[model samples]
Target: MKSLKITIALLLTAMLLACAGNDELDGLTADSGEQQMYDQAQRYLRNRNFSLAVRGLQLLESRYPFGRYAEQAQLELIYAHYGAYEHEAAVEAADRFIRLHPQHPSVDYAYYMKGLAAYAGNTDLFARFLPTDVSSRDTTHAREAFAEFSQLVSRFPGSPYAADAKARMVYLRNLLARHEITVANYYFRRGAYLAAANRGRYVVENFQRTPAVADGLAVMAQGYIMLGMNDLARDATDILALNFPDYPALDDDGNLSSDYSLEEGQQRSWLNRATFGLFDPPEIPQFDTREQYE
Candidate 1:
């Protein structure tokens, strides 16, 4: 009974919303011709009234599906959604346009806008104002954006947006590598040495040429050392020496350095000292690569 009542309530609400939307469209395009409606939408776009522009464009497209300006209106709707910060909506609109008009001359623009929307959605408003590390956040949208941009570049190398897409792809690739390194750092902190080493190896193998590659090597070396995998640690250190000789975690001899060393003559706490540090043993300093990013 309760579920039926809820369903009925939802249906009535949807009907009311549909009626309200129709009423709004009727009022906005009362006696306006197709061109006049399009002009009104353009005015909204020019004035930066994105929400109104989206509404007007949507109405115009629905009222005149066969009108000369129908295709243009669909394209503008995508931009209006983007301008209004409805990134997901913008991506959906772009997809619809591409599917409907695959051979459209401006299809490259739609692809570019789709990728841009996903990229913008990933960063969001909070990330702009906050001190959060983007690499530590969920990477779903970032991966999506990268894939979309990659598609744009692959399918339309001559596109005006190709260069910018390529640039963004580079950043996204680095960001992804950094995320892997960040996870490895976390695993190291938690004493999951094997897990950390695997993460570092994954980054090195998959995210070549990224800035985080150096950090990945550093983490791998440290994790292997912690796990008593001396041979693997030496291999990682040798690679680090050849590639990133000046990495902060390495010393003059290219060996891992303990940055967590105690100051000279600094003693343990009274309880620890009395227990000869058996109860609270000093932690071995782990090689941390996070300092570079910080």
Candidate 2:
């Protein structure tokens, strides 16, 4: 019964979508050729009427898939979806265009658009309006965008979009590395030294050129020290000193500062736990590895 109800709901949703699509096409009647439809979609796009543009472009593709405007219409649909904030749809449209026209002259644009869509997907309305810490949030879309941009750069190094893609890739890499550091910091604060060390090690291994590597090494060293692994801690500090001598955690004498010492029996106050550690927080050893976003 539940399955049948779900199926019914899906059918109703499809019907509503069909009706909405038709409504979006309002006075724009289909002409004899795809050119007219494509033109109308372009007009809608120019006016930022993304809903109308998406419907008109989709209609053009369906009515005249082999027409001269068919490929261009498909490409335009991707932009229309992106403009409408339909990021997943935009990515799918871009992917379809790339798969169908791999050798086409404008295929690089499809790749660029795919990366752009995924990049935009990572930023939600809250992040746009509020001072949210994006690095502390889920990084699924960031990783996806990084991979997409990487593919674009690898395949079309000379393309016009390659430079911008490279810039965004750098940002994403830093964001990803910072996210790992944030997790490591959380684990360290919560007394999970081994887990924190592992997270820091992951950042050092995977994100070499990112600014977060210094912080990662700091975390690994402090976390290992907390776990009584002095040898491992020394190794981490040595590497940090070699690669990033200016690391904030290092003392003037080139040794790990005594500030990050772990207090074995430090307990959180009731007020601290009640406020989620915002007020009257525990005196845990923390490294300020939050590198400013590049």
Candidate 3:
């Protein structure tokens, strides 16, 4: 009986120790697995295999949502989408990061990423062209980009990315302004003076800091002249002169003159004579018109 009791006690002790060892081993294994996942995801990112990196990071984020690596994984996922040229996906990821980690030290980076994604998402063919139609092209993404960039500039003025964001904002602002000018010019060519003036004024009021401001003012001047508003035309010209004194004006004879010699009224009158009711604009033949006959 004594031997049997001793044997039973030994067995119970061994089982308990075994259970403890198993628990310890499981903890180590879980930690190792998390580290491996993080390392692998980083490796993929380094290799420029962005899609794979995103998948790996996403798995880590889903599996360990409250773990220390979750925030890092989320941020890396944003970068991965960007590297893959998945702009909309990147923006979504960035936005999520910002919403979740509002107080995180790297939240500024998330905002910057959002701006970059918005800027990158603008795929307008006319983006590179000087004269582009603002009304015809979707400016939603560009506007979003501007807003995000502005936020970054204001919030993280000392950030390394702030300078670049500011510069990009300048470029985008000018692009938007040019787009308005293109639309105004299109209206001018169509003899839609009121529409042209409104579009031009929109640029002046919204994007006055852009280089296109001078051109926009000039367009407004022309528009006012066409509308028999010589005073307004001359006022626009005056503003242009004050803003850009060195800007040359193209005369009816195609001569570039630096002189703003005409009084406000005379300048308006000259603009009216130059553009209003003078000649018929060249017709733009529509492709559909040709197709209809064919």
Candidate 4:
């Protein structure tokens, strides 16, 4: 009996609001109605009906742009867009909220979501885990994601999202570092010795702690050797052997022994197989070697 009364009351309220909406889009945006609509949207959000939640929030914002719940509705709208996989819209909404309420206590949440949107906005979700060299790929979104996360961490160390933001930043930095190494390797393959060497040097200079540093050192040494810069080659070789003792670039005597050549580095390429394109490649390369990057 109580449930029936509540249902009838809600129906009447909706009918009243609809009539009020006809008079002015926000004519029903009184305090009581605003709370009711916002509460209904919260229910939709809790039910994971993000589309419905989005509609409710949109109505809340449009009807009472300056309502007490307007800011909170905008925040919820961002989440609704994100939950629905509307990544670009989520980011745009986040940006708008941040701009409008720079001093709002919840601004850090907006920043965090901005980074999350970019991180998850890659062309394919699987691409994030693919073995293809990132240097040959478009990493603009990744870089932007990193920047957003970085800002949140740096500006709000105590933010609830700070720890996760730091971890993500580390991953992005490593990814960017590896990209340089891959590009260097590709240049070496294309017989652009100078470009390859320069790329290796960039990684060494910019990305020290990453695993790519070992490869960078090897590429640099090989590039110098091929370019007839024996002294520089020797320096790179020595440093690599010293730091990464088990590195494949080193020989039994802990000396640079292998001639790093593009022809030498061709192992199974994910890009080549992806030509198989998820269904099956026309030909899959034999053997998956972990150390194939050498």
Candidate 5:
């Protein structure tokens, strides 16, 4: 009985979608042809009815591939998909527009929209309110977003969107740097000294000037100490002290302090240990983070 009900519900949804599509098609039957459909889509978009806008735009494109409204319809489809939070569809539409009209003046906007969609695609409703570290999560969309933004800035320096694209690239670069630092911290805490130190070196080399570089150096020094490489550890510590004198990991002698130890992380209060950190919550690692988005 439950299975039958679910099947019936799915059939109803399909039928409703078919009917909606027909209604949009029927509305475009006026003698004005492509203009009528395009106008209808514009109205839906202005009213923020993205679903209807998407349907109308899709119809306009299919029915008038070479019509005067075809190019505009394709561009609007990208915006419609983005507003509806269909990020993949938005990116695909943007790519299609750019491919078909590479030299068009508005192609820059398409590239910008693609990058924006990819970035927002990584955002979740809850994370908007809570303090979440997006970099520590899956980086596929973040990397994609970064690449798109970089392309826009490199190809269209004087374009109005280029400045904003550059700003977003900064944010994305810092996020990637912080991700590597976080991973290195995990290896450090787990006593995998070589793994931890390599991650720290990667951040310093690949993501220079980001705020996370200080922590990366700290991780590198600590990892080297655990592996009994005193000279290397001292070198990392000295550079960190020179660049970030106020860094918390520095001691009075300007050497890396021994505070970031697995022992410190494991020494929980008796109350927390008995309750498995329920009574006294285990401390999440803290890093000096930088936020450029205002």
Candidate 6:
């Protein structure tokens, strides 16, 4: 009876070893399968079938979290999401890549991808009035995009993407300045001269290097005149003349010249004040009312 029991125990041990070997072989096969899937995904990506490529990549990532292709797969996944117009998904993936690989050489590319995703995610202006809108024209994402691009420009100035990032930054800055100018113009037309002046001044001070700066200074000059602040108006006019000497001016005769006498200046100033006051009430008492009371 004891001999029979020993034989049974040895047989059981051999069976366990055989099962272990089979498990290892299955693992190898699974690895090879994943590799094949990754190769196919790369082929799809190269062919610009980004959606199918992303699907394969997603499966590889999910099935083999610590696989050898994990890092490259994550980066490519971001690009795939971007190509598919999944802006939010792209940003999320890029952000995850940055968090996971902070010191990775390709981290800069991840940051750049994030910025591009945010920038392209902006909704069209006309889409806002639609009832089923899922995005906004609000520049909230632009701020983040600017920050990311600025970081790349500052840290990796000589990077291949740096030049393009800088150029895009210039465009974004100009767009932001233009938005300010639009608001300033609205206020100016509504006789909110002080508000208009503040908005225009913001554009001039913050976006001095932008193309809109000259126009911003001119708008500020007009705003100051409307507010009856001749000194401020004159200062703005001087800046405009120095910066853009050929800028057209709206004189009493509707000509675009800077040729005017002191009387003409005073008359233009008063006319501007009156016109602006029609839309915006003065903080101080009206000149005629003050004189009559005195």
The TM-score leader among the candidates is: 2
Candidate 3 displacement at residue 263 in angstroms: 19
Which parts of model 5 are misplaced by more than 4 Å? 1-32, 125-131, 261-294
Q: Which stretches of candidate 1 lie over 4 Å from their true place?
A: 1-27, 260-294
lDDT value for candidate 3?
0.72
TM-score of each: 0.80, 0.83, 0.70, 0.73, 0.80, 0.70
TM-score of 4: 0.73
Report every candidate's CA lDDT.
0.81, 0.82, 0.72, 0.75, 0.79, 0.69
Tens digits of per-residue lDDT, candidate 6, 1-294, equal 686687678768856764554332222233457688688779768977666667778877887789898888999999998886688999999999988999888888988888898887885433433353121236677777888899888887877889899988987887777667666666654556678778878988898777667667767777776666889888888877776675555354432234321222333344456775454432321111111111
Candidate rank order under lDDT: 2, 1, 5, 4, 3, 6
Tens digit of per-residue lDDT, candidate 4, span 231-280: 99889988988988877657878766644422322422455345432332
Candidate 6 weakest lDDT stretch, 10 residues = 285-294
When summed lDDT is taken over every stretch of 10 residues in candidate 5, the lowest stretch is 285-294
Location of the lowest summed lDDT over 10 successive residues in candidate 4: 280-289
Sorted by TM-score (best first), the order is 2, 1, 5, 4, 3, 6
Best by lDDT: 2
Query: What lDDT is obtained when candidate 5 is compared to the true structure?
Result: 0.79
Worst 10 residues of 1 by lDDT: 260-269
lDDT of 5 at 4: 60
Candidate 2 lDDT by residue in tens digits, 81-103: 99888899999999999999999
Cα-based RMSD of the predictions, in order?
A: 9.7, 8.0, 19.9, 11.0, 7.3, 19.8
Clashing pairs in 1: none
Give the alpha carbon lDDT tens digit for every residue of 30-129 in model 3.
Answer: 3357778888788878977676677778777777888889889999899999886789999999999998889999989999999998877876433533
